[model samples]
Target: MSMQDTLDTASRKLLERAAPGRVDFENLVVVPLFAVVAALILGALTMLATSVEPATIGRSYLALLQGSVGSLAAISETLTAAAPLILAGLGLALGFRAGLFNIGAEGQILMGGMAAVICGFSFSHLPFAVLMPLCVISGGAAGAFYASIAGWLRAATGAHEVITTIMLNMISYRLVDYMLRLPWVQRPGRADPISQSVPPNAELPALLQWLDPNLRLHAGIFLTLLAVVVVYWLLFRTKLGFEFRASGASPEAARYAGMRASLIIVLAMATAGMLAGLAGANQVLGVLGRASPGFSAGIGFDAIAVALLGRSHPVGVLFAGLLFGALEAGGRQMQVDAGVSIDLIGIIQALIIVFIAAPLLVRALFPWGFRRPDSGDGRS
Candidate 1:
């Protein structure tokens, strides 16, 4: 064979190795696991660099494990934290799959919480069945509306979602702050800028309150699971989902194939906002029972990492959310038991994202693990 022919064959092989049409089981499982391990190893090294004792580093990790799942109560706390992350991550994943970047989930969450609080306090006489659904619906609608503003701009005015959504996030912060201080929304007797508590009927019932009233785990867990299943079905088993995927993969081709790109963009963003709004409702109705400034606690922002680490897959997002939840729940324990700064957890999370984003680096770090079994010679 000519040298040029050999070079062409080598290039084709390299391309095949680097970019598979679909992720194989090995890549799906091994890549994320390896990235997490690499992050942990680097995190340990970072601790050592900061003058933390080796033994203390070990104890901090152990405390993290115990805090996340050591006991039934710890497991419950992990799940509680995971619930909002999963819901919001799923929303962001949906937008990603539709070729849209929605950085406005934080604002949507705030709007949803504000709407739910307003509904909850205004209809104090409604029955549980009526009040609960009303609050949830209001929250979702409010979120959808808020997110649609950015989507409409993207579709109609050619504005980029990243810039628009980021601006929207800042707007939401100021908007919520103003709303909380209003005479009708604020607590009746207190001057604090907090909303009135949700009525009992409007609150989500704790699933395990019978075991212990202090357990904050609630029916929102079931809602989050249901959302995962629904998103999966929507993405893989429907015509609209096919359109979303096609548009994401190639907008020009989807347009040539007669897909309405504008409609899909708006619809996808609206759907994403609705899911994020539900997350806000879950926080307020299921946990806090009222709206306060900064109640979102950066769940919307962390959800971006969750979506990326999950590779925009619904099932992947669910597991990633759980993992992050465990880290968050354990960080407190590590701080208390091992005298380590909780900021270490943030560093680990950042490292994980960096590794996941650099697949080539991960592959280079674990060559033996990523190596594919050779087929018969001359097969190609």
Candidate 2:
């Protein structure tokens, strides 16, 4: 089978397994949980092999737990980090369901954020009620239009989304840099490729600032939650979503069923782009308050792993995003409190993804925990 066909099969299986009374329990919950545990255990082993002291290792782990959930401050940090991740991951998850590997979220984030920043500052006179929504809408629209380029290419010229999206990512990096240099966008007296601050009225209101002004958690979390519900409804309830799934399952069959394959491809890509754009807005409007070089900070790329661990399901993505967020928040404390290298967190994350992708290896390592997917009995 072709690569697209293979991807479609994988996506279909993922969707099937996500359903009630399906393989969802094994693949979605059990496997991801074990993958995380195994990665952590291996991370400890790596520390031991590196001659790190056992006391230090224990302290590092303790610090990690404390930083992630020990207090309200840590929870705020984790939620702040997770907002953009969950937004971006949901978009990518939608694309995956449609058999589109649109990895250009980084680019989409950049362009969308730039657009929202422009809207925020340009319409500074508008009230917060109007301006905030305007900035968000502009961001989503920009992302959708940007992503549609690859979708259009695929529909019109048979260009693969993987190649096109990667190329778009490269182009977007330079494009943002160029835009930042424009006098209108550039901050006064700043030679660096950074933008002027977005207007205060356009910023997403801090959710926890009433309790602590330093809290980064913002109303963006609400937006992220809303997107999750919308995506769930779209993918499982709407006829358009069925069409998207149908196309992914078998393009030929979808065409035979009279679905507009070209339109579906473009719409799917554009929809994913919109979500990514919203993520960009969440970053700029809720957190950064402006644009800069590499402002997205690889959130787009990391979201790919989030989507994978979530099994491309909206609810799954939510939990996965939060888990990754906790890891990030905890990793910082691990470094500061225990003087452990933050790189260990990266190693653990990589190992988790490796284990997630290779479930058979995890099953082999812990045979008692998992049943074979095809087995009716408990035996593998």
Candidates in order have lDDT scores of 0.89, 0.92
Q: Flag regions of model 1 displaced more than 4 Å.
A: 1-22, 372-380
Which pairs clash inside model 2?
none
Report the C-alpha lDDT of model 2 over 264-347, residue by residue, as the tens digit.
999999999999999999999999999999998999898999999999999999999999999999999999999999999989
Reference-based TM-score, model 2? 0.93
Candidate 1 per-residue lDDT, tens place, 1-380, comes to 99977876786577566656433544566788899999999999999999999999999999999999997777888999998889889999999999999998899989988898899999989999999989988998998999989999999999999999999999999998899999999999978789999999998888887998878898889989999999999999999999988999999999999999999999899989998999999899999999999899999999999988888999999999999999998888899899899999999999999998888788889877764433313333
Model 1 clash tally, residue pairs: 0
lDDT score for candidate 2 against the true structure: 0.92
- TM-scores of the candidates are 0.93, 0.93
lDDT of 2 at 343: 92
Looking at model 1, the pairs that clash are: none
Q: Sum up the clashes in candidate 2.
A: 0
Best candidate, TM-score-wise? 1
- Index of the highest-lDDT prediction: 2
